[model samples]
Target: MSRLVLLGLWLVCVLASAVAAIWMLIAVLSGSKRAWRLAVAHDPLANAAFGGNEDETISIRAGKAARAGER
Candidate 1:
């Protein structure tokens, strides 16, 4: 009788783990898609905040400065 109870508890734990893993996977995939959309839209602020390129490269900064000089 105790063996049956243990088996049932084990099964419940396994199912719960599987459900949690699936939920986490879905959340990650959804977030990645949203980030991709934001990148494709060229949202510099959002991209810099979430995508980890907070500092602009020297060349990019130079280009922007040059463009400003043109105006």
Candidate 2:
């Protein structure tokens, strides 16, 4: 019974996410800055998905990696 409840909760989260994604898609298409900010969600993959510059992201990551090695 607990497993079934967990599955139901998971499904609810999935549906909510899907709805949010669709809303974001509409907002993004309309060029809403707020929507873009929410879409980024401070995630590299999210930024990349929304047309962030790949070269810049790569250079930033590389610089961080290099700095870490120096520490």
Candidate 3:
């Protein structure tokens, strides 16, 4: 009975470890993909995922466009 209990505990530990590792892997992969996309995309702030920036970023380019429009 003790041996069986120990085996069950070991199995549970292994399963928990595997699940944690997989969860971490998914999080890391998703985070890496987001970072890579942000690096390549000039949107900065990851606003593209939301409803902020479509073609141009407001923080960086909005000023220039505003100035051009004023002229």
lDDT of 3 by residue, 4-68 (tens): 99999989968975775566567567775644443444354334545555665655455765778
Model 2 stretches with alpha carbons more than 4 Å out: 42-71
Query: What local distance difference test score does each model get?
Result: 0.59, 0.68, 0.60
Worst 10 residues of 2 by lDDT: 40-49
Backbone clash numbers for all candidates listed: 0, 0, 0
Q: Pick the lDDT winner.
A: 2
lDDT tens digits by residue: candidate 1, 18-67? 77556656756777554444333344443365543546543455577688
Clashing pairs in 3: none
Candidate 2, residues 1-71: lDDT per residue as tens digits? 69999999989978987887887888888988767765655356444556655434544665776889941
Q: How do the predictions measure up, each by TM-score?
A: 0.41, 0.51, 0.41
Q: How close is candidate 1 to the true structure, as a TM-score?
A: 0.41
User: Which model, 1 or 2, shows the larger lDDT?
Assistant: 2
| After superposition, candidate 1 runs with Cα above 4 Å error | 32-71
lDDT score for residue 44 of model 3: 40
